[model samples]
Target: MELVFCLLFGGPSMVGALLELSKNSKDHVATSTAFTFFRLLEPHVYFLYSQYRFDKGDIGRLFIAGLGSSMLLGIIVGSLADKQV
Candidate 1:
């Protein structure tokens, strides 16, 4: 498959950070493919979400900030979650 060949020809850095984090996972190729697929879709998904979520304000600000923006309120809880772990 294309993913297998990519892994074969490329270095670990080209594949991504997910592979580095999942070093003990049984299937490196599958982990890379999943992370790669998510990376491709994440930006588009955020763009679409900004359209509806911030209909009047500066959508670009939210898009640029991604998840860390206080608009989502997740950042507040993220601090708590990080402390627990």
Candidate 2:
């Protein structure tokens, strides 16, 4: 199904994107730029996903749900990274 495909494909690319955004030293050229671009453009991706029957409320709600989950995980990972570093 398309939802499975979306999850399988979008999940890793999204994680890789966030990892790249969080790491990388060349702030002016790569990480910051990619992060900004992704931040600016991500709404469009969610907008497309909102057209699906599975989506409730709207794109903003869907994105916020994802953002909430990501932040929870990010906090745990960030804490672990701090201990490691």
Candidate 3:
């Protein structure tokens, strides 16, 4: 089950990393792979942490909180990128 979850999330990430690797810059491979792994780890880490910290009855609150945080993060990142340009 975990293997399938990993493969599903990782397959595209690995493919993108390999594509960058072929471009012959070791730095791109290292960075992209690290980013991919961290991104994939995020939701699992959140889920586990929620399970440890919150009651099952709090699912609705957790869902709302997750959505709000994610949306705020996206907005902040977008603004930063826009500023960077």
**Who wins the lDDT comparison?**
2
Sort the candidates on lDDT, descending order.
2, 3, 1
What TM-score would each prediction reach against the true structure? 0.30, 0.43, 0.34
The sequence of per-residue lDDT tens digits that candidate 2 reaches over residues 1-85 is 9999989999999998998889756664655777888888876686667667546566667778899999999999999999999
Error of 1 at 11 (Å): 27
Estimate, for each residue in 34-85, the C-alpha lDDT of model 3 and write its tens digit: 7889889867866886878866557557778889999999999999999999
The residue ranges of model 1 lying beyond 4 angstroms of the native Cα positions read 1-31, 46-57, 70-85
Model 2: clashing residue pairs? none
**lDDT by residue (tens digit), candidate 1, 1-84:** 888877776656666776567687565555577788988996786678676775525665556676456646786778889999
Residue 30, model 2: lDDT of 50
Clash tally, candidates in order: 0, 0, 0
The true-versus-predicted C-alpha distance at residue 16 of model 2, in Å, is: 31
| Model 1 CA lDDT for position 17 | 72
- 10 residues in a row with least lDDT, candidate 2: 51-60
Off by over 4 Å in 3: 1-57
lDDT of 2: 0.81
